[model samples]
Target: MSMHRTVTMLAGLLAALLVGAPAVAADNGLTVLAAPPASSGRMRLQVEVTDPALQKELRSSGASPDRFRVAVDQAGAQVKAVDRMADSSRERSYTVLAFDQSKSFATSWPQAFDLAEAYADELGARSGNHTVAVMTFGKSKSTHCEETTAAGLRACLARVEGRGTDQPVTRLKFYIQEAVREAARKQPLPRGGSREVIVFTDAGEESPALKVKDLARDARERGVRIHVVVFSAKSAGKGIAQRLDEMSQLAEGSGGRYIQVGDVDARQAVTGLVGALENLYWLDVAFCGVKPGQTSDRLSVEALVGQTPTAWSAPIDFRQRAEGTATAACPGTVVMGPSQAQSGTSAQPGTSGSANPPGATPGTGSPTQPGTVTGSPGTGTQPGGALGTPGGTQQPGGGPGAPGVSGGPAGTPGADAAPSGLPWWLIALLIALGLLLLIALLVLLARRRPEQAAAPAEKPVPPVAAQPAAPPPAAEPPPAQPEPPPAAPAAWKDPFATLPETRLVVSKGPPGLEPFYRVHKSTFTIGARQGEMDLAVNLPQLSGHHATVQLFKGGNVFVKDEHSTNGTFVDGRRLNPGERVQVRPGQIIRLSQHLELTLVQPGLQPAEPSSQVPIAAAPPSVPATTPPSAEAPRPKARTLYAPARGDDE
Candidate 1:
């Protein structure tokens, strides 16, 4: 179905629910629903919490920031208050609950729901009448671009929708200036009441109209608790996916959490948003390296806060490490510069310096303003009036001519290490060799073996004299070799765009079979193609680690070892997985004792007729049953099926 149609259907269902669903609570302002400001009224109440579970429950209950139930206590606390439903057209007041919105994750919908529940829980304890606002995307501006159509709208939404689809596939760009202008005109004045703007965008601005950084700054200045929902792009090939990745980075540059939507649950998304909308205790994390490990590009981190896995951050690249350093070994923390780290110091385990004011512990650190930097004498000035010039030079500490060396006297070096000049005989030898070119060529030609003789001498002669040779057969030219196939195409792209040309062949198995052939999980199987059975196991997605593959011909085993953050092993031996290693015919591939398989002949690279060399003669008499590896040495090239040649051509 078209994305637009799906959205419209959802909108209709929501509207229908609003109209038909009966009010469960009695009328006493018990059910508070906050509408998007029409002109900004008395400050609305926005609830921010750090609980993830509470946020999840409310979002699943179909509670919007503008709509949900709360109870008020009577004099003796026995009388329960009821809710007076507001007209759809009337001005509405509501409450907002943000759950763990401070987390730096691309996906946090689960947290948003938790926040909603927390707000409800808090409401249960209140003495007087209270209201709750569950933040949600209300209505989009009617400014229609060329994006009214499904494809166009999908593209447009790809730009604005928070964590809905893959960034690389979403070729979306909003006219920034136009969007900002529209946003400004449409936004109501702040109603002294508390309000939160939970933003769901890739934190990018492709539109020439809006400056995303400026917008974020404005939101922060205006007290808009901008909770971001990140959408990451999946890159497989060229063009769109690659550009989306760039766009995602641009969006994240503003310090907003980004969530990539690849095989991710929608409920998780909403919960994450709620978590951000409400202040949650989701732990912050940072990595030591830009990429997670030396070889793995993905950094899968699960926080064990309170003894539970809180959330996992999207994979960050090593390239980003150049701009900033990881604060610690934790994931989800911002990649901050050394200066930023200093200013934002907390009691985290690792940081450069620790600070202690009055009554503070010696080693315990607190946030401190960055210290001013002073340069040594004779330091060169940069274009921005900073010390240290681009080139290798030091300014004089004293006036222009004064020697400005600052770091103490230069240490004296040891005596000269060795002579610099080359011996005269080496040059003379080169000159002599240059003069003997003709003699050297003649010598080389004479020394050439018979097998290296000229092509003309190797041509076969026809036996015409023996029997008035038969008519020479017509010569046929050789056929050209085929090129390799292209890489696989993306599995999805608005599936309805075109018909499926290739067949999706799935293997059917016995009834009540377990889930086999998982995409990333490991599996074992026996080889059936060749005469001998070879055991093989496939492990696609390992524990955030990479493996190398190797084949040992002498040993009866083929091993895949773990050379990654998480190691892989075949039985007890670690074989590098993820790399291609050849297993010659007659070898047994072993994943340690865990799995085993014989290397079938048919699977090995076909031996070229011209490439294979004949086996060398055995020394005297040897056993006929001797193994292949123990056999006498053989020539590098062996003839396959070469046809006898004619002389005429």
Candidate 2:
């Protein structure tokens, strides 16, 4: 009976505790997205707020400039302007797709082409609204492609199916710089909204001709957002050495995202990109948080979301040099950070910069700006610029600035402040009510105990069970669960699904190239760009658009130099650009310095041609020096040339 009473009381107490849970609103899901430090002594950091209940992202609406608690390391900073990306695409947005197009990536160009075309078509499918431009970068520069309609853009993208120019892959820094500058000035006059550049590549060589800081500066000055998507995802983040790949490094420096590619296929990758572009946020802050003589690339941001300010993100590495603000802290606001403690300021706890000039608004601290920025992405508001309501009168908080009064203790900004939690009285009352219920349950159980005890006297038969109970048989051990079978090996998929048949294989190359490119296309370009070229050669000597190989039906072949920086050679003789030279399957073609390819037609042999270049072999019957005329030189090696076919013949 006593045991039963103890259990009942414990159950009652547990119920009471469950009823006293404090009401917690959504408070902790703020993420500081990206902060690209600008060379102009300014920085922009993007953030996204989430609805805990819905598990979806939302804007921190009506958040004024003062609501943000920014820092450079531990020092305080101020936000000069606030801008929200507007949701509606009332105006067309300009996006530039800058692809490095390295040959190392395993890209399915036909499939990728379809994916990209679908994207462009979808953008313009509705009333034919054109929205994107594409540029495949190489050694020098190639003109961007933008069409009047989706079909035109499709055709332009189709042109990407062939190989690109002869530009070396080592010029990553130089190429990105050029792309940024071009994006800034190339948009048509009609595009009045946001400008973005999606840089794609697997890897690249860093060139010193243009410094990283210079690239960051140009991206900012041009108001272009740099976002990178790489094919080899392993190199997307920091490595074991804590060093990022060149692609990611460049992205971080330019304040761009190193978008992760979950799947190797381009359809899935492109789809995710399109969706992210439509849903991301772009925020700018004039963070002056660095201390004197202190320089860092890490940025810190926080905002008032609860009883006090909370960190928006951990210190992020922007790669660009970040400097401190001249002022110690935003006037009247105490420095807030992950480690810094908050305390009362001189002005007052609840007052919003009350000591500022007569024009100052309470929480805003700044009286000069009328309203803070407000809009979703695709809106007309540009980043790094102010877009508040039309009320900047200096007469002490009389204009739209009054909207800032909602800011309260702990530097909470107006409507952006965290929602009020349940009242203390209501919480206390519920707890008391739970306690009363517990007491009633306990009393009911106590009263029922006596009744239960009084009615339980009919258990005389239980005495029969007292006869010595034999120890129960020792429990048998349960059978062991079967181990799962080893997983089946993944099936292999063909890398060259588009080719009709295997006509050529890379007989020699770096390791892991055992089954190099097996191309059979009658005429295809070969270069550093995988998607743009027929046979991608990642070697340094090969240019972006190196040469085009034409497979003659008779097993004869022609190699035409595409005006590559390094001339192509047939048996050591340099072939001029655009000049097609005939050669046989046994002939070796050289590109630039180190790359050599031996042509082969497995089961086919073409007609033997007249020896354009002399062979050194001499018949035994003929006198070595006198018989063969000096003009008819003997062939030192077994070299073969394709007979002139068709017009050449």
Instruction: List model 2 lDDT by residue over 1-649, tens digit each.
Output: 6645555666656554443333132233444544544444566555544324222323434555665555544333457665554454553556676666544333523444555676675666453323577877655556567665777777778776565433455355676776776666765322334456776655554444666566665564455656666444333222211112344455655545554343234455455444444333444555433445545445555455433444244455553334434333333333323322121111112122222322333324234432222211111111111112112343222244432222221122343222223455655765676676667677767767754335545655544545787899999999999997655433323322233332434445544443433334467577665445656655544556788887645455778998764568888899866778777767777776556677665545322222542222333344333333457543443322211222121
Top candidate by TM-score: 2
Q: Tell me the alpha-carbon RMSD of every candidate.
A: 26.8, 25.8
**Model 2 misplaced stretches (Cα beyond 4 Å):** 1-67, 73-81, 88-92, 101-112, 121-130, 147-151, 162-170, 186-193, 204-223, 232-244, 252-255, 259-266, 278-299, 307-311, 314-329, 334-649
Q: Report the C-alpha lDDT of model 1 over 132-234, residue by residue, as the tens digit.
A: 3322221222232322123333343333334322223211233222232333333332432222332333323323454445544343223233333333321
Model 2: which ten-residue window has the lowest total lDDT?
375-384
lDDT of 1: 0.28
Give Cα-based local distance difference scores for all models.
Answer: 0.28, 0.48
